[model samples]
Target: TGVASGIAQWENNAFPGDRLDQLDVTNGQVFVQKVDGPVQFFAQLGAYSLPDLGSPYIRSGKATGNFYGAFPQWFVKYAPNDSMSVLAGNLPTLIGAEYTFSFENVNVERGLLWNQENAVNRGVQVNYTTGPLALSFSWNDGFFSNRYSWLWGSATYTINPSNIVAFIGGGSVNTETVSSAVTPLYQNNEQIYNVIYTHTSGPWTLVPYIQYTSVPSDPQLGTAQRASTFGAALLATYALDGGYSVAGRVEYISSTGDANAGAPSLIYGPGSNAWSLTITPTYQKGVFFARGELSYVKATSTTPGFAFGPTGTNTSQTRLLVETGILF
Candidate 1:
């Protein structure tokens, strides 16, 4: 279990318009796991107070308090052999450099790429590992839906003890029909791809990753339009003596095509581009930790600049966050 508290400030009026400068209890979680022979079980239940900074649809409706919300994860795994395993339940998506847990991330807020991608799914996955190569395949509910079906796969290669690379890809299709008509009302398909690389040396670690996704247009709009998004991020961390460390991250994202589509994209609307830089300093001693970060974000649109508020006026913003927590 863990408890974290922090303060955040935004230069311009951002999404969290109500509270621009207020104390927040970012995360409180409980993790339980059991392993016996070839069977394994794990569960994570927590309440998160941080606002959904990037994607509004993710965990947006789960907030019950000013800065408190609940999110849960559970899964079971069975291994029949040393090289193969099967898992079923709610599992974290395996496509991004950052994890769902706050403590596992180098920075306090997720990057543009991480927010655009899917977070978790309920389904079954099979994995196989041999030598320096690992492969996995999964079938799950589409995107964040609980009904539709989607399929995804991943392949990873361990180049050496300190270097590794992975490729993850997935796709899903949805269709609707009316009466006995020969044509369907709408047919939609979505695809996503990601590449991640990690390298570690001594006290320094680096991760560089890229992602692309295509979203289908909505049928209610009565138009066959589509939008696509591309993004990349680089993260680095270095550790110093006496439980001190520093980290930095840089990211870029672009959205093109139909601007009115209901698909998920980066910060701004379609035909928009954004870039950000973040720096963080951290200290850790025993089970206690503290971190401070400063970030700058700038966005440009095809027209009307960037809209961070009720009016499409602001084009850039800066944020500062400081947090401290304990892990026990």
Candidate 2:
């Protein structure tokens, strides 16, 4: 589900120099998921409306990424045997699923550090597992820049059910040398890696994860060249007997990328490294559920124009959110 408010201080700061009233309402989303024997599928469609705050003039538009407010995805998986499985269609990024929970996300929005390059690769991934040993690989049509063809493979070892770790990494070589339509970026080749560790004991689950991505810089956008971000989320969830629970998440984010080299500035050099802590209390009974959350984003970098847009540029921001979801 999504949340909206009458007073939004994030978009375009001072209301983009246009507003018809002192009040507004936001829209949420709806989705459904199911598992039929060996096949599983899920999808969601969300719609939202708010101040179309004018573009705040910045050297680089790193502050926002086309703020087009729609989140939709669907994927289908098939299992023909115990050691083999296949997935086809548009699936969520693997790194995203391993890092954060869908519910209890402090802000309605996700960060910009790397999602900009998280191509919604549409294709297939294969996996095989055998008594503590596993191998997985995938082939996808490049969705990030429309140039790179990403074929990935990985090997895994599972110590135990609750205590497990996977060291996954992949590489994308440029299959098409088309000039970047959005900028002058000619992504020649890139390497990506994910280190995910998950442990679940009784009522608590912990995941200490990291992702490293390297993409080329488009000189036309004043590209901050070769940028990367280091971040972690410590999530603690407590489940109740019935259908109620509370989760707390503390996240720290920092960027190690150039923000001053990209073309015209849409290239998104790293935003100011920041840390945010959020907690969400939720309750659900039957077809109804509600969650109340609060978040605090603290800017650690003094970059002049890099800000989440609370009031001005390059400052801290705090957001309060409440979301309710239902199924029929």
TM-score: which candidate is best?
Answer: 1
lDDT of 1 by residue, 14-95 (tens): 5443444556665677778876769998887676543333322123224423211243457899988889999988777777
**Ten residues in sequence with the least summed lDDT for candidate 1:** 179-188
For 1-328, candidate 2 gives per-residue lDDT tens digits of 3322222223223213332223223344466667666888766555433211122221112212332224434678898778898887665444442311133242333443234234455667898999998888877644434343777766667898887777766656543443432222322244567676778888776766666655555444334475545556565667777787777666665556544544122222254456656666778787666666665656665355545443336355555555565534
TM-score of each: 0.85, 0.68
List lDDT for all candidates, in order: 0.69, 0.51
CA lDDT, candidate 1, residue 283? 96
Off by over 4 Å in 1: 1-11, 16-18, 50-71, 175-189, 218-223, 260-266, 302-306
Cα error, candidate 1, residue 245 (Å):
1.0
* Model 1 lDDT, full chain set: 0.69
Q: In order, how many clashes per candidate?
A: 1, 15
